[model samples]
Every structure is written in structure tokens, then in C-alpha cells.
Target chain A: MSEPDGGTVGKAMTVLDQVANFGRPVRFSELLKDSDFPKATLFRLVQTLTQQRLLTYDNQAQTYLPGLRLVQLAHAAWAQSSLATVAAPYLDELAHKFGEAVHLAQLENGQVLFIDKRQSVYRFDTLAQTGQVAPAYCTGVGKAILAFMAPMERDHALRQQAFVGYTPTTHGAPDSLLQELDAIRASGVAYDREEHERGIISIAAPIMSDDTNVLGAVSIATSTSRHTIESLDRFEAVLRSTAAQIGSAARVWRAPMPANPSYGNSGGENS
Target chain B: MSEPDGGTVGKAMTVLDQVANFGRPVRFSELLKDSDFPKATLFRLVQTLTQQRLLTYDNQAQTYLPGLRLVQLAHAAWAQSSLATVAAPYLDELAHKFGEAVHLAQLENGQVLFIDKRQSVYRFDTLAQTGQVAPAYCTGVGKAILAFMAPMERDHALRQQAFVGYTPTTHGAPDSLLQELDAIRASGVAYDREEHERGIISIAAPIMSDDTNVLGAVSIATSTSRHTIESLDRFEAVLRSTAAQIGSAARVWRAPMPANPSYGNSGGENS
Candidate 1:
């Protein structure tokens, strides 16, 4: 029910999304290219957002990044979110167990927002910091959660925008993308298969509440050379059990926020 | 030159500050009680911040907390800041070496904004999560940085507010605080002897670049019962060496933005 069109809040979100995509404090000129946002509008939006502390304007770099206020907001959201905190110890254990990087991410606006992660002491990591966002159609955590969304909801989410191919192995075009999501649903697990970044592979499973509401997804990420299909199958069982431990523990902290007309996740206006 | 007086941005920032003071989100009535601001002001401010994605509104909890955008922003800042990346691995090593909590913090609004942390693998931990802010007057990392700030910058910063004491050990008067900072500058390290919290103790070393500009601070935090004065002396040498390694490594990635008149640290106006 929320308008996704360009407005102050929407444009501010777009600028932030650009920063997230690049994982850099993008210069204003660079943001203009992919965004196609008007120059003046972008400036005003960025300025206001910076002033409000929603964005950080680096005087030394002349670039835009999300501000401390933004981090605080994400902390607030995740604080209410059970999966991030409850799974912290589990993530560490899983990473230690597999000697790989394990991540827990939940889907928001059709993308995977990495809430927590633990990397093995000797793993090669591409530096995906916590709170980083990645596309849902390609990554294991993304695909794991995508498999569970109601068909219509999933369709609506995918239809919300175009998918950019991150690597040659990325699945694009709606028809093919939908087929892959369906495959994940059938299997109860998802594989990255180097679709996000070359040489990286991951195996993942979703966690659900006692009521069967999908909570989030967890993954064991590693270089493809280290994990074969058979090896991943063995890891998946551990992943699933680990996710269950997380979900059950999350129950104590992941309480539902009271419904208020003015606040909450961007859903249930219809409800 | 900028007014610190209350306005929309001020209301919004204060709202965030209040939310951070809480362990979790609180109801609007609770926010009113927690803050000196009026009810209507708090409500309107919460809605604006929620809409702008600076704060999250939990209809279920009927309370507001920091939002996802803030987490994204902090992560973004963490990603872009060379200090964070260079020190991350070493921070881990130091934490493992010391078998206690280690933290990296930068000065923001004369307070220590936690940039990163590694908790000791123990059953109990004292300090809060990643985005938690601690007073500069009491904490080791905060004192390390503040004690080194260019004099005028330091004075102007202290002029902006009152010192609300958090603990009996917290320094309440600005003059005593400045004197302590001066003594810390004469020495090379800063120590927090249960000044922030009653049972916690920490030793911090300032991270300085080749040109000796203060980059940030790294500290080893532990329970006083776990460490004695002799142990801290030995630990301080490790902290200083680790900070040097981090400072030097960060130099290779020093793509600092030009100092813009419009952009400034909370302590001083941009040059």
C-alpha cells in the first residue's frame, strides 16, 4: 500500500539503495547515472537527509553514505527481530563447524538484508559486513527465503523491479528467475552456485516460527572449491538444525510489536 | 554557527538519542516520560523519523526504536571508513590475545560511538551492542581521542552541553574533565577505572596516522576482577602497538573527503 514512486522519502531511499549496492560512499555524480534522479532533487534530498542524520555527507570525500542515525534504525529493527540476535551464537558455531562463512539474512523489499554473520578463522571472505544488503534472486540466503513467500506475494515482489545480473551465472528474466525460485521451494534448500560472485558458493535453509511464518534464512558460504554437492548436502542438515535452534531461541526476544496505524513493517495495511 | 536549539532535526536527533538510551523500544507515553520534550512533539518527531526511515515504528510494541536505515548507514560508514577495515582483523587478534572484550570507537558529539567490537568468549559481557554510545568523559576510547583534540576544538565541544552523570565515578564538572584530558595527553594512554560503569575497566590507546592525526582509539575492556593494575600495564603496550599497525595500514586507503564548510564532526566546524 506504500507508494514506491519518487518523492522525498522515496528518493532518500533510492540514494541509500545506491550506497548499499556499491557498498561505498558514492559521489553524487556517480549516483546520478544509475539513479537517473534529477540533479537538484538529488542534492536537496541528500542534503536534507544528511541534515536529518539519515545520510552522512563526508566533507573529506565529497561522497554519500548512510549515517549513524541509519545504523541506529537498523539496530532498532534487528533488536525487535529475533533471528539476528538469537542466531548470533549459532552463526559462530556454524561457521566454526563448517570452517566457512555463515550468514543470517531476512528478505526485505525483495532483497536479502544480512543481519548477522560469522566467518571461520581461516576463510577467504569478500568482506560482506553485517547489515549489508544483497539481491535475493542469486544468493543462497535470498533464494532460501524466496522459496517460502506466497506465490502472489513473491510475484508482486519480483515484479517490483528489474533484476541486475551481478555475475555471468546470475538468473535474470522473470520466467527463468521464477523457475529457480520454484526449484528452491521444492528442495527446502537453495544453492548460490556462484550466481552472485564468481568462485563463491553457499548452501542455505530457512527458519520459521511455530506458526509456520517464515522468519529468515541462514547459509554456509564458502569458496566453491571447498564445497562439493555431496559436502553441501551434509552441511544443509546442520544448517537446518542450526536454524531451528535459532528460531526456538528467538521466541523469547522476537515479540510482535503492537500494531499502530502510524508505524510497523511496510505490510498489513490491508489487514 | 549552526543553531543547536530544538527544531525538526533537533527533535529527530533527540528522539534517536532517547531511543538509544533505552534497551528496547518504548511506547509514545514512555518516550514522553523518558524525554523532557512534550508529547505532541515526540509523536510528530517519531512519525517523521519513521517515515524518513531514521526510526522504526513497531505497531505491535506500540513503541519506536532506531530503524533499519540507521543500521545500513552505520554499516555503510563502517565499510567506507579505512580505520574500521584496517583495524578489524587486528582488533580480532587483540581480543583473542587478551581474552576480553575489545572495541574501536570514534568521537561523535563528544561521545564514543562504537565503530566495531569483539566480545570475549565468555558467559557474561557488560558493554552493550555495536551502536551503543558512551560518554567521552568516562570511557577510555573517548578520553584517548578527546585528550588529543586540538585545544580550541575541545573547548568549543565542551561548551555545548551539561554533563549528566551516569555513575558515581563519572566526572561531572567540565574543568575537572578538561584537566583529566590534559593529563591523558601528557601521558600516552587513557584508562577508564569504572568511570562509565561501576564494574568495568578498560585501557585505550589513540590510533594516529603517520602525520599523527588522531584516527580513532582501540581499547581492551574487561571486568576489574579479571584484571589488576599490573596486567593493564602490560596490556597497554599491546594496545599501543596494535593501534600503530592499524593506523599505518589505514593510510594506504586514506581517501578522506575534502573538509567542507557544510560538513563537520560534532566537535568542531569544518575548516
Candidate 2:
């Protein structure tokens, strides 16, 4: 067993997570309403976090946001934990070769997190900021990784999906998404047919470890005006080959995966 | 006053910071040598941090590195605290205009921290990675920001410099560096004359808020082989103007700076 007050640290981290969920500066009262802790305890915890620089207080708006130390630490994590570090050359190559925007994404707690991106030398605007998350049910990279996951893990991740309908073509329920996943599994690729946003499309492939475990996904995204769905199919072989190369390179280059102490043997080796 | 046990959280943070300082995975014994904590206390703290996923243990190497959750949190920090968000368009404009590598940097613990970078289309090998740290005395961005800092803050920052000679032209003491900062303050720009590393030369200017407080610094880095120091002077007016635009743009954008409770009234209003 850990220290008696170890749970206090957990509680403090929960508060930190809640603030990050907001994606913008939040007032103390706003945080208080959503947090489970009592007002006095929450106040003390926030004060301590502020003192630690884990949370910064803006005296002007009287709001709290994530601090710079997290950014410094995250840069280290990005260089190590994610595919961004290992796949940089591949991503640069794909971006230059295809002349399309390239995306590198990983699964974090069942959500699709965009870890890195290479903007097309040409300009087109969309909201895929490096840290931003998107629905697993409608995006190409999300579907590609989900298609390759072990059945139990895939089911668990599917259950976490919001299935919010952003466009009329969006998958509004699990059944429709499940049908697509089967096709994706057979083809070893996934497509986004303006399902998340109108006029946006992508072809994604899962990057797999040499052990055949899914590591992450890579995609070439473009506006519908540039390429039709049939034309997009031309990238399938090259896209999958790029993903495989990145995966194989990553497998040989990075450190061995560690077992999750909390999950014991039940947690798979992949995260 | 903060809680007496605030030191407990501080101690835990020290353990976290120690892992980050390594830049790569580190074994427990390696950390122990540099750590002030008793063996047992450090062990308990490491266990707690591992449980929290603030540090991930690589079982194969038996080393610890930063975890994914920290990256997720840092993404939030990078979006808010650093100039990455507000300066994106400005950075893009500068890169296209100068066709040179552009850097956005801020002072962290009296050292220069590169928060964002846009590489030149041409090739040159250098150590300017985003999220990388460098000494304050011999770099362009470092001197640019240092010249604008409040006197006490600047002096404290100066005391932190190692005064290590990286090259024959490098500043080896505070007196010479102080003289350069005076000229920088007057000229509104700073230059790195093959100081930190041979062949790496740059011209930099500080980004200031509407109140004329230094927010960060921006620079155009080039190799001495590519351009002479006098030829680099041609970018001076444009570089300063770009820095001014980013400063003014950052002024209207982002959250208000937080007051450092430790520094009392002397910490100033700009973050």
C-alpha cells in the first residue's frame, strides 16, 4: 500500500484533468461546480497547484489554465512516448511526395489524439491542432487504428465513442461504425468520406509493430475539391507501405514496452 | 503562508523534475546519486509518480521517462502559455519572407527555451529543436529577452549563467555580456556572433506587450557560410518589424499574466 495521503495527490490530479478538459481558461467557481471535492478542499488544492505552477492564475480574468511547465514536460513526452519523434522523416517525405497535409495520431484513453502534422506547402484550413482530439467513429486515422485493435480492446474503445453527428454522413450509432470497421479490417485501410466534416476526406492506414500490434496511424488528408473518392484510392498502396515502414522502423528503434503495474498482466503490452 | 506540508508536494515535484532533466530514460540508481532524498523516500515518490503516469517505467531498461499524460497536459500549456498559438501566422509569414529558419523562444528559469521553430527549406545541422534549452549568455534570443527584463530579474538571470566558453568569440563573463545587452537595449536587436556554437549566427529581437514588457524573443538563424554578419544586417529592420507585429498581435490575444506570489510586487505584469 502507498501513503495514507497518496489519494490526496490523485484528487489533485483529477482537478488538473478537469481544467485541461475545458481547453481554455476557467474560473474557480466554474471548476467548483464540476468537481466532486468540497469547496474548502478544492480551494486548498487549487491554491497548492497554483503554488506548484501546475495551474496558473490570471488575476485579470480571475481564471486558471494549464501552465508552461506542463508544456516543457510534454515536449519530452512527445519526443519519447508518441510516434512524432520516430515518424518525423516519414511524415516529411509523405507530405512532400503527396503535396497534401499529413497527420500522425495515437489513441489516448480511446480518443484519437493528433500528435503531429505536416502542413501542405499549399494552404487549406481545418481545426486539427496538434493536441486536439476527435471522435473515433468518423475519422480515418481513428477507424484505421480501431480496425486493427484486439476485439475486446476495440469494443472497449467503441463504447467510449460519443457518436455525435457532425455531418449528415456521420455514423450516428455503433452498428454502422461496426459495419465499416469490418470492411476496414478486410481492406487494411480506412476512409473518411466527409463523414466528420463536409468537403474533407482522408485515407488512413494503421502503423503496426513488427509483432503485428497497432502502434498508431498515418493519413493524407485533402479537400474534396482536390481529389474525388475514386482518385483517393490511388494512394492506398503507397499509404499502407508508408505506415508499415514507420511501424517497422519504430519497432526496431524504440525501447521495449512496459507492463502496466495497475492492470498487471491484464493490460496488453501496447500502450 | 502555504501549508507546512506544501514541502511534500514540492518534494514530489523535485522527483518529477529530476526525471525530466535527464532528457532520456534514466535508471533509479542514476537518479539516486543526484537526488537529495533518502533512498526509501525517493522510492515511495517514484512509485506514486509511476502510478500517476507522470513517469513511465521501461521494464526492459528499468529506466523512467515522461509519460503520455504529461504530453497531453503539455499540449494545453503550449496552446496557451507559449507564442505557438498567437504567433503561428506571423511565424509563417516570417519564414516565407526571409526564407530562413525562424525561432520563438522564452526565458525559463533564466535559460533560453525554444518553444516553436520553422526550419529553412535549405539544410543546416544545428541544435535548435523545439522545446530544447540553451544558455542565456551566448545566444541571440537569450540576449534579446535579457536586455528587456526588469533590472533585478535580469541580474538574477545573469547570476545563473554558467559563463562556459563554447567558442573563442563566446562571452566568458558577466561584464562583456552586460556591455552587449546595453547595446542591444539601444539598438532594439541582438546578434549571436558564433558564440554558443561555431558557424551558428543569428539576429534576434524581443516581442513586447502593449505595455512594453518582454513576452518572448524571435530570431532568424543562419550559418556563417551562408551569410556574413554584415550581410545579415539587411534583415535587421524586417526582423524587428516582424517581432513588433507578433508582439502587438500577442498583446490583444491570450490570457493576462499571473502575478508570482513569491516575488511580491516585483514580478511585473507580463508573463
Candidate 3:
């Protein structure tokens, strides 16, 4: 919270996330509104991050966003992170079995970075913007992974977090969220319960790493209008089984699937 | 080719490829053998890149590879490069229809970047290593795209190029490569013919931007033992139609897939 050295890199990272999280190139004013940073600080952060190739700018549009450098970096990290590949078959299977959208995302700085997504053939508004960020407390996949974090860390995250109530029921309290996470950890499943958006529910479970760190979470997102909670419970079983299978796969040969997971200080790979 | 500043970025990128292409972290000595640079200068470059987070260093192993920052960069690039997302449904349809590996790659700086890939349900070797680079003259997808390049640029890429003859059947002659491109252009399809590998055969078509610039190429790779040219042709109609579908998507979207169609690219999202 204190900065005089400019925290050049951290500031740049902040600007990058704002854009990366925006799901599209963001205008400078949009940056200020989203990050709640001072206008001048946001400007310098954008400019420097752009100069570093950590962020790229489209001059004509006067917008800022993550640059090619991040793609290059993500590719390299993916080789080390095996979640992307490990979850592919499972996500594919989930998509096929459920005829709905399946996705894998990691909690980064308290938001979801969708690493990979599979669309349903059924054609629904379930289309997710891969690499887009959403509040960690509202989505099943995010809560599933967050449930595994240390109690202290989870509390800290909840305290400092700014959550948007996409619907009327987005989770907000540390105590209540703790209960949800405990349920996920105990039963090996997490549910959206129409919290993230109206008329949508997702069932999710965490995929672990070799050391049993929650590396990321996988989920099936569908419409609440289409699938009732009882049917969703059945699909939750499927989602949990799929996540477990991916965990075993990740530990076996460590193929490059690259889903960002909450590793419980296992390199802090998660939030 | 020369000293420090001349090929600074190239050598650094080569080290990146060595790690990325192999799907594992590479040792310093192994990297030394893979590149032709003085040890001292290589050390500096690696350190600088690591410092910049363009690359990473594993302290325990003393090996250098791409860092999470690079993955972030790649992800950021994909965030902006909408080509992959736009083309994904088409790749999905192609994979579902053909039940083979589908890859979308772009030529970048005389190499290829495998921006996006989807595999069949059955087992197969991986076709994409997201950021790795390889030769352009000998790959089906490579030639298919190169065939669309401006003549002068294409000729320039071929100059002083050693075709390496991945197989004896590889077209090493500049004349033959030019000839093949012509046929591909005429026929609207390009063939690999076991040029890149003995057991693999592929056919590719280009996805062009609204400006008619070749944004990237897509290919279907299958085993020579199981898939004959005729069999591949059986799927050709769908493949070409799928490619055109992706092309149209790219044009309508104006934003290229969330990936740069880099040169001689290999592997997908496998940092």
C-alpha cells in the first residue's frame, strides 16, 4: 500500500490485469474505473507496461491491453503448467456428456483467468471469454479452488475483495464462504447456485497437482432454466470425477495443460 | 548470425524454443549445444531475459526456460489476437467430423507459432508446442501459408535455407517449393506428403484477414498408416469448408484469433 520506488513492475502488472481481466482492450478511463487507481498512476502504469511489451497499446484507439510479451510468457509457463492439457479430455468429455460449455480457469489475484474452454454443440449463451476474469467468490470453479486455500489466506482474500453481485446472491461473507468451501472439499464438488449470473449455474471441482495442490478448477456452466438443482447434482458428480481424473493425469507425466491452480503456497500459483 | 546485438533476440528465442519444443526444461549445457554463441554472452542474455521475466531460471536445477511472465504475455497476445477464438468452433467442427488432430498456426519471423490446436479422442502425438519455432519450407501448414505470402517475401524466406530433408521426400528445391505453392493456390489445398515426418500426412488451407493478408493456416494431421491421401481427401471437403468457415469468422470479427500466426510455429498453448 506504500510506494515510492514506483513499484514499476507491480504497477505494470496491475495495468496488465485490468486489461487482461476486461476481456478486451480497455480505454484509459475504463482502466481508472475498473482498478480504482488514480488517473495519473494508471496512465504511467499503462505507458510503462506497454513500453515493456508486458502490455501493448493501440495508438489509434487510445486503449491499453496485455501485449505479445504476455502471450510469449504464457506459452512458456504452459509448458511448465500441465493443467491445460490434463483437463482437455475431461473438459471435452464434460462438454459431450452435458451438451453444455465446459471450462478450466485458475484464480489469479482473486479473479478467474479462463485458460481453456470447450463450447457446447447445443448453442447457448454459455459462451465464456477465455482469459476473462470474474470474481472468485461467485463461480463454482473459483469457489472449488478457493475452498482449498489456507483458512487465513481465504479470509484475507475475502476481506480485501470487491465483489460484484452479478445476481442477487453472490457470496460475500468469510464465514459463509468458508462453509461452501468446506462442502466442496468434503464432497469434492462446488456449485454456483445461480450466484454468478441470473439463470445460470455451474458445477465445479478442483484439479490438483502432484503435491496435491489445487492447481485450478474445472466446471460445466449451463442455464438454470434448463437443468434443475437435482439434475445439476448428478452433473456435479461428473464434474468431480473429471477433475480427479485430470489430477491423476497431471501427476503421472506432467503433460502441458497449463491451467492456473491454487497450489496452497505451492508457488502461490493461485490467488 | 554475428555477435551480441546482431542476433541477441534470435539466440534468446532459440533458447526459449529448445525448452518449449521439448516440453520440458532444458539445461544450460544442452542449450549451449543447441545454439552457437559464446558462453559469457549467452549467460548475459539469459540473465537479462530472466530479469525482464521474458525467460525464467530454475535455481535448484540451474536451468533456464520461459517464465510465467512469458505465459502471461502469450495469454495477453491471445487475449488480443482473437483469431484462435474465432476459428475455434471451426476447428471443433473439423475435429468432430474428422476425428483427427486439428491445428491452427501462423508464420512469424520466418518461423511458425502453433496458436491453437484440438486433438482427436483417440491417442496421437502432439502437433502443437505453442511458442516453439521450426522451419517453414517443409511443413504442410507452413507451405500452405507461405504459398500465400508476397512473392518477394516468400523468395527471401527460401534464400540460403537448408531444407534439412526431414524425410528424403521433402522438397528441398526452391523451385519445387514454389511449384507446390502454385498448385496449392490453384487447388485451394496443400499437402504434406510425409515431408515433415515419415508417418504423418496433412492438408491445410489458409485463413485470411479482411485485408486478404494470410492471418494463419489450419491443418488436419493424421497417421500415414491409418490415413491415406485418398482418405484424407475424403475429409478434405469438410476440412476446406471448415477452414473457409474459420476464414469468414476471422474476416467478420476483424480481430484475428487470440493468437499471432507466427512463422514455422509449433505446439499450442504448451508453454
Candidate 4:
């Protein structure tokens, strides 16, 4: 809550984030305890957000939760800005063909933000829900996207990584992770190897535009109980093809825009 | 373009809404054309929003679209505040059982806001996407929720209705809709009868808590080519039971809150 630099808008967004982070309908007092804003400022910010329908105040519960207006705005974001909508049919095809969960993700704020997922009907619980975030260093989709980024952009993103090891196989340092990225760049695929979670592993490929710009990544994820690391390699060819198809489709959809040298290829900055 | 009531936060939100309404990545010039703010004011606001990641500036396109942060916040809102997550399993069941699309919606600002939808594998094109808003006076889910609302609350919602006929079967006045609501109340369900969209009809039931609080509504929608108004009645019993099951499950999930008399039954105010 160090005052974000965008003035009143930033403060208001910070307040919105505070409420969302509570992850439940929360009391004003609870928000106050955690907020960096003064009591009066916090109150005014909350009131403004509620009035604008950015946060909904639950009367009976005497609590506030993220509002429906966010969902409305987010729908536009997902449909317009994200590759999720463009990749949906491909994800569905891959998921159905393999009968495993598939994830579509983009680098956001130097992290892996899962924008969409297709869970098979035979759903085994996997932690990757749409909109969930994970460390870029340890996840398959994240590494795949990172591996394909321009060197400068990749370096910037790597600088932001904490590289906390979540499992024995997790990357413990930027150097170690960079080595794997070099391999992924050569092979055109990345693997999770139960790095982010104990049992879950995935095979992932970076989706690249026809011009070789990194768009995002898609992954086919499963449990160690279901498949060994060697067995996961069986999906490599189909996964890469699906990624290519989505990338081609997305490029067509985005063809109207003039290309700027500064965007898309920069791993997560301004994403 | 009128300045909204909540000051800077309001103005900022208005800008955000403007971006979302564009429904595509749009240039600053395009946004300026539609904006009411002075050029300097608009520039500052846009810059602020972009910095906060409430809107993402597409450098390559030189345009802006709603941002990934909104998607993350929206995911929490959908999971925590919306009935979508609660009704998901039931929506899946109903959609599979009938091989028709099932919609979950809540009234927001006197309009029907679809929070979730389950489309059958045999997907026929329908206008109802998640986060899509429709008139409350005519749609099945809208009418069903209105039928169960407390009288004063229902009246408040009715006054907000424009009552423009979308089809020949659409309700044209409060009196006509009130008459239908009475029947729906008596019958414990509502039918669309191609009122909102020709050839598309639905059977809907209000999801109520054990205390009879209207949580929201669920509708199973289909085309006239698939089902007649009388034939739609075949789903009435199962639809009502599904709504009841969802209501029970949601109530349990929400049981931590103290009962407030003024909320949940108010149709759309503060929703």
C-alpha cells in the first residue's frame, strides 16, 4: 500500500486490491487494519468504489466484496485483450483429445497468469484455475513463455524472479532456470517436472506469432499418478501444433494493429 | 459524459468503462472522440489507469484494452461474490441432462446480468455470454427473480425498466409484466416464450435460500426449432429442483453472515 504513483486512481485501485485480497466479504475495520491509507482516506476510497459498483457492500454481512462491474469489465478484457478467447477452441480440442486439463497463460507482472483453462469432464483437482497466478520460474507455461522472449526482455523478467523452490526439482536460482530456458528454446517445449506443485506436472509450448513474437503459452497438465515425465513427452508434437494453430489464428485476429517494436516481446513489462 | 458522483474515482471508473465499451483495442484519439473530459484531463486519467494496470496500453497497436488485473479481480469476484461458482455443478448437470444451455444470472442495476453459462457440446449460437446484460422485464431469469422479490423492491426494479418490446411477445408495460409475474409466482417458474429474442425461449426458476431469499435465477434456454412453449414445461420440475439444490448449497456457503433484512431481496439495488 505504498501509495501507488497514479494519484487518486491508483489509490482507489489499491483499495480495490485490498478488498479483493481479503478473498471474502470483509469488514471495513479489517480492511483498515491492513491498509496503509489513513482511516478517513480509506473510508472515502471504499465509499467511492462501492458507489461506482467496483466493490459491493453486503448489508446483512456488513462486508464488502469485489463487485459485479469488475466481472463485466473483465469480460471485455478477456475477450479483447487476452488470447484466451482466441485460444479457446484449440484448448478445447487439445483437452478433449488428451482428456487432460489444458491451460492458457500469459506473462503478467513477471508472473504466470492463467487466463483460461479447460478441465476435462473426468476432472482431477489441479490448482490451475483461470485467473490464478504462479511463479514464472517454476511453472511449465511460464518457463515456455520466458524461454522464447527476446534476450533483453527475458533478462528483465528474470531479474524479478524470487526463484523460491516449491519442490526438490524447482529452479533455485536465475542461473539454473536460465540454463533450462536455453534447452527449452532449442527443443521448443518446457516441462514442469513437479516444480510448482508436488504431484502436478505439465508439457508446455510457447505460442509464437508468424513473425516469431511470443504470444503466450499453452500446457497440458496432469498428475504424477497418471503419467511419468517420459510419458508426458508423448504430448509434445500435438501440443506444439495446437500452440502454432492458436498463434496463427491470433495473429490474423490482431492483424489490424500496426506493429510497434516495444510491445508483446517484452516478457511481462507493461503486460 | 456527465461527471459521475464519486469524484476522481468515479471519473476514473467512467474512463475505464469507456474503454471496455469500445469492445476492442482502441486508440487514444478514438477514445477522445467519445469522451466528455477535456483533452488534458482525459490524457491524465488514461495515463493513470494505464499505470495502475486497470487498462493496458497496447504499445504495438497503440491502443488500450481492459487489463489482466481486472481479470484477476473478476475471478475472485466471480468465485466469492457471484452465484456462478455455487451453481456450476448444477448448471453442468441441467445442461447435460437436457442437452440445452443453462444460464445463471443475478439482477444488477435492474438488469439481468448473466454470471455463468453452460453450453451443451451441440452448441447453437445464442447471444447470452457470461457477463452479458439483458432487460429485466422480458427474460425468463429476469421475470422469475422479479416474481419472487418483495413488492416494494419489485416496484423499484419495474420503474427502471424501459419496457421496449424486443419481440411481439415481449412485455410492453408494467401491468402486462405484473400479470405475468403473478402467474410465474403462482406456477413457481417463468417462461421466456421468445419475448427477448425470437426463436429463443427458456424456462427459468428463482434460486431462493431456505429462508426464501432470492439468491438469483437459473434458466435452461433453447431455440423454437428444438422446443415449444408446452414442451419446455417438461423441464419445469427438474429445473426447480436444481435451483433449490443450488440455493441450499449457496446458503451453506454463505452461512457465516448475519441475516440482514434489507439485502438480497431488493431485486438489483446494490447488486
Q: Which model scores highest in TM-score? A: 4
- Lowest summed-lDDT stretch of 10 residues in model 4 chain B? B262-271
Interface RMSD per candidate (angstroms): 5.0, 4.5, 9.9, 3.3
TM-score of model 4 relative to the true fold?
Answer: 0.93
Clashing residue pairs in candidate 2, if any?
none
Give a tens-digit lDDT track for model 3, residues A122-188. Answer: 6777535555666788888889878887666667666655666677788766667777778878888
Clashes of each: 24, 0, 57, 0
Candidate 1 chain A weakest lDDT stretch, 10 residues: A262-271
lDDT for each residue of candidate 1 in A1-271, tens digit (9 for 90 to 100): 5555333445566676677666766788887777767888777666766676666666666777766655544556666555676788888788777778888888765667788888756668844668787888888888787778767777776775357788898887778777887888787888988888888888998887664467788998888777765677879788889877887887656554344434445445211
**For this target, which candidate reaches the highest DockQ against the unseen true structure?**
4
DockQ for all models, in order?
Answer: 0.40, 0.43, 0.23, 0.61
Instruction: Tell the DockQ for candidate 1.
Output: 0.40
Off by over 4 Å in 2: A1-6, A255-271, B1-8, B28-34, B38-44, B57-63, B254-271
Write down the lDDT that model 2 would get: 0.83
Candidate 3 chain B — worst ten consecutive residues by lDDT sum? B262-271
Tens-digit per-residue lDDT, B76-140, candidate 3: 57746657778877887888877888888877556666777777666677555555455678777
- Report the lDDT of model 3 for residue A179: 76
Error of 1 at A11 (Å): 4.7
Q: Of the pair 1 and 3, which is ahead by TM-score?
A: 1
The RMSD (Cα, Å) of candidate 4 is: 3.3
**Candidate ranking (lDDT, best to worst):** 4, 2, 1, 3
